[model samples]
Target: MTSVSIPRRMKGVQIKNFGDAEVLQYKTDLPVGVPGHGEVLVKNEFIGINYVDVYWRRGMMGIPPNGIIGREAEGTVVSTGAGDVNSLKVGDRVVWLAMGGYAEYTIVPASLAYPVPADIKPGVAAAALLQGLFAMSLSHKIVQVKEGNWALVHAAAGGVGLWLCQLLKALGAKTIGTASTAEKMKLAVENGADYVINYEEEKDLVKTIEEVTGGYGVDVVYDGIGKDQTQNNVNVVAKHGTIVTYGAASGFPAPISHATLTAKNIRFVGPAESALMRNIGGGFEKWCAKLFDTIANDKINVVIHDTYSLSEIVRAHKDLEARKTTGKVLAKP
Candidate 1:
């Protein structure tokens, strides 16, 4: 590792009291701690904004108050602690998902840091890590979408949805996506969706999607929008098909009846990204390598809805919660 300048203090967003975006506090006096053994210090250049970050800000998730709040970020490594951990070196450009990413600097375990390719911008790197991995696992592993197969993606303009749609296209599968508005539907189409349904204006969404698929239901349905979409997804899914419901954006799906599944021969599955990564067989390194190649080669592109400076962190959360943004939002410090 080469020598680098050190700093003693930096700015970070502190969660003093969790309630909403208003509760996020920006502080310039946060201490920049030295990296501990097996960890490296990253000067965060871009912090990825995700709904999970909203969960933390809304107090929906249990996390300590007065701590930095962010999950995914891309940055330059400035230093490393003792021990040869994960073959990390100073000056390496990297992506990481450690906590405290909404800061000038984040200290992450070397095991958690992955070097980014030269051509991948910090915005793309930050957006691709969490959502990209989820899309890869859901499209390629969980669903095993083959050529000519069909999949339905709800919230197709969403962070994960857009990426998933692109990956499905790369695999030669078609996507029938449902978006809330005409603009969003257009965005979905631009992101590789073969068919788009304006769910907000359309009645009988399931019937519409079925009509698109020529009366045969889709092979798989990615339901990020829950609640009322449950029955729609079930009715629109083909026999022996799978439903991958990963999020409850509108709210959890209403309790399901087992008879419904049995009658349609449907299989409902939802796996956490952490657990699914373990069962991916090839490990995170290989999965990431393939995913990065896809993005670099233009097989999949990160659709950034908006970008904010570190000072506008609160507005970032507000934009996401109000559904005013599509795809991914990024925060640059």
Candidate 2:
């Protein structure tokens, strides 16, 4: 490793007992962890704030007490432990998908870290990697989206939602996106949603989608809003279409009987993170490469809702939970 000064301690946020944002105790004296074998230590420049972070903080994701939280970050590889790091070297700009990113530095498994392209901004890479890869998986792996397919994307103005809209459009699929507010609906449309529905104003979601699809329901329904929208997904998806319940922004959806899926001959996908992670070792590297190419070629737009200081993480959580953010939320440490 090239010579570079690394601090003994770093600033970070940890939860003593998960409950709310208040439990996130930020401190300047947290120990900077050393990279073990097959690990590389990153000096994070930008950290992505995801709803999954909220789940972890709220005790909904089964995190142990007194642990740091955060899943993804972009930074420079400062040092490497004793193992092959997949060609990673000191000073390489990289983005990693790993836990404990709400800190000045993070120890990431070398396999989970991908080098960032020179033209892509670190913050943009941070904002795009995890969500963009997930959206790509949904588009290409979860359901083979064909041209002319009609897709319904819930929370279409959000980080992953915006990505879904653009990816679907790129695949020649028409999209109907739902948002809670008029502004968000407009953003979704601007991001390539063929039709935008303000769910807050639309009384009958099923009827609205049916009318939009002209009696034939959407070819696929991406329901990230979870509990509040899962049932509506079944009503809006076309026969043999897929319904992907990918997140729990509104809380996990209630259990649905297999008969419910059999009734319509529809496919239901509730992707487990563990199963998703099965691909992370190699699949993510490929996805990130493709995702960045799309972004660089102007096929996808990365929208940042707001960037907050690491100290303002509480406010960040509050705003995200309140649905005040329209796109990706990021933090600088």
Q: Of the candidates shown, which would achieve the greatest TM-score relative to the real structure?
A: 2
Residue lDDT tens for model 2, 1-333: 487799999998888887878888889999987889999999999999998899889888787323988989999999998878888989999999888999999999998899999999759999998788888888988888999999999999999999999999999999999999989999999999999998888889999889989999998999888999878998898988899998898888888789988988999898754367556445767777887899999898999999999999999999999999988999998
Pairs with steric clashes in candidate 2:
none
Worst lDDT 10-window in candidate 1: 58-67
For model 1, residues 1-333, the per-residue Cα lDDT tens digits are 489887898988998777878888888889988889899999998898888787777676678434787887998899898886688888999998667888999988887788999988657999888889988889878889999988999989989989988888889998998888888899999989999988888978877877888989899999877785888888889999999887777877877679988998988987667566556768777877887898889878799988899899989988888878899999998
For model 1, the superposed segments whose C-alpha errors exceed 4 Å read 64-66
lDDT score for residue 307 of model 2:
92
User: Model 2 lDDT vs. the true structure?
Assistant: 0.89
TM-scores for the candidates: 0.95, 0.97
